[model samples]
Target: MSLSLVLAALVAVTDSATHNGRAGQTTVPAVRADTTIDVDGRLDEPVWRRAALLTGFSLYQPADGRPAPDSTEVLVWYSPTAMHFGVRAYEPHGPVQATLADRDRVSADDNVEIQLDTFDEGRRAFVFIVNPLGVQADGTKSEAGGFIPGSNVMPGQNDLSADFRWQSKGRVTEWGYEVEIRIPFASLRYPVGAPQRWGLQIVRHVQHSGYEETWTPARRASASFIAQAGKLVGLAGMRHGQVVELNPELTNTAAGAAAAPSGDWRYRNDAQLGGNVRWAVGSDVVLNGTVKPDFSQVEADATQIATDQRFALFYPERRPFFVEGSDQFNVPNTLVYTRRIVRPEAAAKLTGKIGRSDVAVLSAVDDRATTSDASRPLVNIVRLRRDFGRQNTAGILYSGRTSGARATTTSPAPTRAWCSAASTSRRCRRCRA
Candidate 1:
């Protein structure tokens, strides 16, 4: 058969359970209910009972199906301290060679990326990628700038080992060989509570056969797990620590210069001290304040991107001078300045949940060195968020800047209003639409 014809057949076969003679025959192993754990350290419960797991349905697709000799089976589990994931792969055809590229490099061929949404909503989550050779890929949030590699916490061999287990199982009919994995808790983060719903995706790659697939149906391979992850049900009685946390920091800087009049290089060190405090008022609320904040750690622009087409990709500041829960305060189109905010000689931030509403507020004053050119402006921002449940949210935000000068002029004050919704059910109007 032509490659296109074969690929079309494979797509048809995988889309539902009828195209292939194996109609209802799923390659995924049957998961027994008894071999799982809840968030409260209880056994014999579903892994989703404590934390969320991302489903990986799009990673596997046959490249012009030709009976390629590569395949994999995956099992998932979770606990309070960590999440467990295991994959058994068959490669009788031959191993495909590959290389790693990105912030923290790892082999890209024949790998798995498990995306998890603790809230069963795509708004927030983590992405973890693991290669057949056992290389780990991770990313995180920082205060001074966009996601950078320096912030990555590489899992130690012991930590990865604690969560991963593998066993080689000879072969399976005409498909190929097989290998299995078991992942443990202590490898993930989630909120503490009961009856939680998690979004999950499991990705797999068969480089030689050029086949990739998922347990759940997926539109494409490159699609983010967040977009197509499936829902994990039956979570209740799990223990997650408070979703809010506080972090504070202090720093200093020095510089030197030379002039012709002096005919000599002069060195000088200047020390300016300041600190910022953050309080997690609740799951959706946070508060932050800073005195003499510094932006030294703020990252430089990406060398590869020459144009500023999209909104300047903003990086979370790491100076510890801004609230840690920046994502919670995201307003669609308003200017919510948290980083490089004219180095407010002093500032304060408030964020968190009140009842079912989310709120955030910030106030800061521009200092002499940073605000001398322009009239020192005191900046303030406030926002209120309302959740409609099941991943739907509506919110309003207001931002303003006032000059310290006598004229007391404020211009270009902006406000934003927006709403969004998401769901897992294929029948959900939002998902279908």
Candidate 2:
């Protein structure tokens, strides 16, 4: 088999509360729902009336720190197994634009967004968005310090490749529109403890009105978007038990040929088996693996109009294996780009948090086309990082590759760490071979 073998191990540590600015100060209670929430976009549930109400949204675009012309009310509450949100947006300036489009394709329409930092990490967030018609889009957002050197790929960009199990509904009202959302705890990864405090923010986009407002003061000058998020308190007894998901696929082919018209037909049949598995060891640790997987692309790459492009385009990772818990793999430098792994015969990844440290390990055998020598290069990468002093992180990266007669290693010199969207002065590392 023509393949390459790779093993990656990462260890990092950070204090979640240290980097989060104003999160503890501006707080919203996540009430425990006493009654069931019927996600019908009507907000008729009794729990909504008793749940914490979040209001006073401010303009985040065209201007900042100013009260929005229109008003939006959000209800925050939770059950033992899931978190729920109810949004009522009043838009008197213009008509709401929406469509029955596919998922992750509702940015052109008037929409509401929910940003949750499950770990209160002040950098990464899971974003759930819905249009007036209830079309949904969800993804993970990573906040890196700045752009890596020699790459057009910007950090802190959002990747909508991840899909979670959730429920939502929306309806257009006379005042504006309302959206109902329920996100299960199983679909999220948080610290393995009770009384969870998370970073929360809500955003509304008025396309026709040409305005964007957020529940908090999302200033453009802020260095970190998540750091400016409000706090979510009162999640006392929530639990996300171990979750296991298995997807099995089988392929079969049959062929027949006859040498002569009088001869009996000969038949050939072949079958192959493959699948993917995910096991949540706990709330924070997860194991993902694939065996003889049918790695197929589901979504097409976004179109880019490049009239005078000088650098290669950057396409985010969309494969299920690479996208799961991807934020844990992010570093100051783009050391391990999973897209280069092309075709993998087998792959496995492990990610979790232990104490203040984060750990991630990935092992894969890439089935790249090769020669008669049947040589598979062995590649190993290791990264170690420690974050301190509020958004300042220091990390070391080492990658080495060895084939039959070739060997190469990369050890980039460390520099300042992650760029915060909330910080004004910071620097990023320059990765080199």
Candidate 3:
């Protein structure tokens, strides 16, 4: 078996307010809706009329901090189980950019995007995109400072595979176009409570002019702007039904080996089966288990490497098995790489919070090919974290690899672990007298 194993237990403690930026002062009040939203893209609904509006867009890409030449207005509202946003883009002069593409592939035309840090941590976000034609695109982003992904997406730069289950509707009017987006809370992760304040960033992409003006200024020279995004106040007292999902699949493969120098060969065909189960432990934690799991990646890995690079290149994880709850495993350096466990036969991962501590654990076995010179191995990872005092966190991370009867470990420093995006992040150790 060839495999990679990364396990982390993270305890995130931050003010949530001051960790990213001080000028992120934008705020929106919550609106309770008793009326149904038709989502026909015509902003004539009664719910939209009562929702608080957000305006005054500023540029961040193609040009930064410049006032948008065109007007864009956004409004937000929510029910107990879902969240909503309405967009009214005015273009009185001629035609507006619109495309008729399949779902989750709306980058060619002028679009409006929303980014939300549901956890309110300065680390990650769930991004959604919609074109004037009402086509949609959605995915997750890694924003743990220093490195960023898909900054200001254009035609070729966007990764359409980043998908999340959501809905949108839009229609062109004589004035311009109107859009409405509906996102379920089940599709998002949040701490259970009343009146929660989450981080938010609203972006308007002007195609012809190539403008990526956001609700708040996101400078290229600084950390991830989503972490520095504005505030969305009043998300409280919501309920999420228990979620259970089971995936079962089968595979067929044929291979042969030469029996003699005369070209005689022995060939055989094989059929394999497997399944996976996920049970959400309430709205806060998730438990997942698999039996001979087969995650045949439908899309190819996007590793467009050059022939002249000086060091070995590590590709990012695109397989679904490794993508779930990946945030808890982040470190500053390359200690545990998921791609190392390229083909996992069986694995289990658990993610959730216990009091003030956050934890994640992953265990996997690999009998597939990883390196040209080495055989596959068993992988195990553990991460535990607790947050206290300002935005600082202290945690421990350890990863081990075992093949046959031999094994080795990667340990953190006495005071702090080696914090690398390839590894993990900041921590302050406790003193023992």
Mind giving the per-residue lDDT tens digits that candidate 2 earns over 1-433? Answer: 2232222111111121111222222586567864566788888867776667777788889898788888887877888889998888888878889799899899899999899988787877898999998899998777855432223445566567778889999988888998889999899888877778999988888998688898877888988887888989768787689999999988777999985878888889988798899999988889999876765545566786667678655566777887776666667656667666666667788888765567777777666453233555444555455656656566666666545435435569786445553255434344211
In terms of lDDT, the poorest run of 10 residues in model 3 is: 6-15
What are the per-model C-alpha RMSD values against the true structure? 19.4, 19.2, 18.1
> What is the Cα-based TM-score of model 1?
0.55
lDDT value, candidate 3, whole model:
0.70
lDDT of 3 by residue, 302-418 (tens): 656667688656566656666667666655454556777767778899987665566889998886465443555778999787766534567888898777434435568566334
- Candidate 1 lDDT, 1-433, residue by residue in tens: 8999999998764553211211222222212233433222112233433222222233335442122233445555444333455444555667544444442354346665555565555544555655654455543221111222222222211011112122211122233322223333223344445555676655566556556655445554432435455655555434333333334456645566786896787777767777656454433344566677566765564445437686464543454555344444455442464655746788887765555465677778876566545566777878777767645678877887766564556689784332243234234344443
For model 2, the stretches where C-alpha displacement exceeds 4 angstroms are 1-25, 146-153, 253-269, 300-315, 368-372, 376-381, 400-433
lDDT of 3 at 251: 82
CA lDDT of every candidate:
0.47, 0.75, 0.70
Between candidates 2 and 3, the one scoring higher on TM-score is 2
Q: What's the ranking of the predictions by TM-score, best on top?
A: 2, 3, 1
Q: How far out, in Å, is residue 201 in model 2?
A: 0.9
Stretch of 10 with least lDDT, candidate 2: 8-17
TM-score of each: 0.55, 0.79, 0.75
Q: Using TM-score as the measure, which candidate wins?
A: 2
